[model samples]
Target: MDLTPESNQDDEAVGDLSFDPKGALDAGDGAVLTRLARAVEAVDPVPDDLVERSLFAITLAGLEADLMEAVYLDTPLAGVRGAAAAARADDTAPAEAKTITFTHDSLTVMISLSPAAGGRVRIDGWAAPAAGLDVELHRPGVDVVTVASDEDGRFAFDSVERGRASLVVRRTDGGGGAVSTPVIEL
Candidate 1:
């Protein structure tokens, strides 16, 4: 068979069609773009909390706090927050409470999450080497809440809405720098 455009019935060359990159798109062009967008969405949809997650990451990146590593988990999940976060999505699973422990240098922080009064979470936390400290609760789309730890290095948040959250701890006496736990799904 002849490879030339003339060999075909239509005889339309590949270069026959033209598109102006800077020019305004016509109705047909708009329809084509719209179809492309819909196809992309159908193939790979975006997460509902993508923007929140992105903002959370950006905020954490600029905080300059020491990132504490997850040391212990009381849930069935074996790994860190990532695994725990994944495990909590199954509603059919048992309503077992979760405890996560994170540490940085000499400071050890532990938090236990349980059901609260209004379908929220109650965060009871304790820090070792008990000193005056400030713990801030951070969620993707909510305002940060701060509470001071008592003399016993214990603190509690009465209620918090469930979602991706983290805790940032700082010394109240202006001693050690700040430290933050990994983002976990609550």
Candidate 2:
């Protein structure tokens, strides 16, 4: 089933039957221990050597932490910070990670980047007002600076380093603010 926002409400109707443990037994063993044994046997286990090789690859490729985090989220994982974040977003609308915004009392920013030859990069930024505004580019370890926007409220980075970078947009009006997009790899 598609795990869209609309379908999540249907989870309520399935009820506790979804967590039944007896259903795990592959065979109809009358005894609990036999059922458990049969269930364990029915599952195929990953070999120790294969597991070690996979772990090596994950660590070598920098995927070990991300994989572990995914596994943690799939289980009954919890901590004070995670619990608090979940509680606050229960009724809040989910925001797109790729986009940010800034308004009179708020700000929004969206980013898309592309790579080019000769250690160059291109960045695309959008803002609400297509009026007097300034955009800036911040490369790793570089001093913060501002950029100019075209008439259409768009700015571009002709050629930037192929490393971490950030974009910020400001307005000429007194009420304008800036937004720093997440670190993007060029």
Candidate 1 deviant stretches above 4 angstroms: 1-55, 73-94
Candidate 1 versus truth, CA RMSD in Å, comes to 8.5
lDDT per residue as tens, model 1, 1-186: 676554565444444557544468977799999999999989987855656766776688677888898876355644444443544565444444678889889799999887665557789999999998999998876888999999889999998887888899999998989999877667
Predictions in order: lDDT: 0.79, 0.47
Which 10 residues in a row give candidate 1 its minimum summed lDDT? 78-87
Q: What is the alpha-carbon lDDT of model 1 when measured against the actual structure?
A: 0.79
RMSD in Å for model 2? 17.5
Strongest candidate by lDDT: 1
Q: lDDT tens digits, residues 96-184, model 2?
A: 12222323334444444444445344556665447566766655466655777776677666666644444555666735344444333
Instruction: Kindly provide the TM-score of model 1 when superposed on the true structure, using C-alpha atoms.
Output: 0.63
Residue 177 lDDT, candidate 2, scale 0-100: 43
Candidate 2 regions with alpha-carbon error over 4 angstroms: 1-107
Count the clashes in each prediction: 0, 12
